[model samples]
Target: MTQPLPTRDTIVDFIEGIFLRRGAESYLGEAVSMAQHMLQAAACAERDGAPAAMVAAALLHDLGHYTNEMPDDVLMEGTNNYHEEAGANFLARFFPAEVVEPIRQHVATKRYLCAVDPAYFQRLSDASVYTLELQGGPMSGAEVAAFRANPYLEACVRVRHWDDEGKDPERAHPPFSHYRPLLASLVTS
Candidate 1:
């Protein structure tokens, strides 16, 4: 009996709330904070001339990480919180499928990339590789084949690329307020 997030402003405020408080906190084991990572991703998407839907997805791709009260130490303790599913489910109530689907599949996109491209695995950061192992490692042949068949697979991969490259603590990017209009337009009643 889960409900989708409320109005677009509520949803946007929820995101802003997280960023205002926990934004400065370390992003799990990554160098940048959570807010920085998300901002970087969103900025990257915009720079690449992505659609508004995808830019929104990139901005909120890791919403799962904040959906619950789970301890951040869970990752250190070797736990997979499945934040992707949590985020997509929560966002589904307020956003179109285009925005939500990419968030849901970003993790799988990582595995899919790892499966199809050996070089891809080598490019991951140490923290990413660690989480990849915790996330069931690379995709198997069957998993890769199934992943390939998904229509939103490309979207997921695009977000994944931004997610991977968005971890720089020193990276310069605009503030979260820059995306407010984009997020507001996509918000449902």
Candidate 2:
């Protein structure tokens, strides 16, 4: 049998370690840290009246960057680092469906928007564009059709919007530490 995943405290510790070692340089420029970005996004989601679960999902959406080092080629190729997959996989062990599903579906949501919404991709920053190419080029028609069929489309859209707008620290949600108590309770229970 496989070993059990780390406890929630361990996951939190892992997050702290990422904050200390990676800082923000990996995600964007040094001007804004990953932790800061996540918090800002979470805050924005919360302020916009998103449910607590979605706000939490927004805050932790990029958790994969902290847990694993994405290859630069993957970053450049525009292929999904499976960040959504990774983040969802990790969080699902501890968080409820309300939290995990949105994180899992965020990337698909982005693709769906890009495919149908004419102005959607244009708003992405240069870096985002570069990454998008590597993440598998605009969604194919089949992918779009698949996305349209999903029930989680609304949550995914909200999460994607929070994600794109979240890079700005000033406008995103509160710090990750703010969710620590809630995480701890979930893990221990």
Best by lDDT: 1
Q: Give the TM-score (vs. native) of candidate 1.
A: 0.88
| Model 2: per-residue Cα lDDT at residue 63 | 80
The whole-model C-alpha lDDT of candidate 1 against the native structure comes to 0.82
What local lDDT does model 1 show for residue 62?
A: 86
Can you give the TM-score per candidate against the true fold?
0.88, 0.78
Q: Which stretches of candidate 1 lie over 4 Å from their true place?
A: 1-5, 69-81
* lDDT, model 2, position 105: 81
Question: Mind giving the per-residue lDDT tens digits that candidate 2 earns over 47-128?
Answer: 7998777777887788866444432332343344477777676677677777788888876677678788879999976777
Per-residue alpha-carbon lDDT of candidate 1 for residues 9-104, written as tens digits (9 for 90 to 100) = 577776777678767878888899888999999999999999999999999998777754333333233334588877777777788988999998
Assess the local accuracy of residue 135 in candidate 2 as a C-alpha lDDT between 0 and 100.
74
Q: For model 1, what is the error of residue 32's alpha carbon versus the real structure, in angstroms, after optimal superposition?
A: 0.4
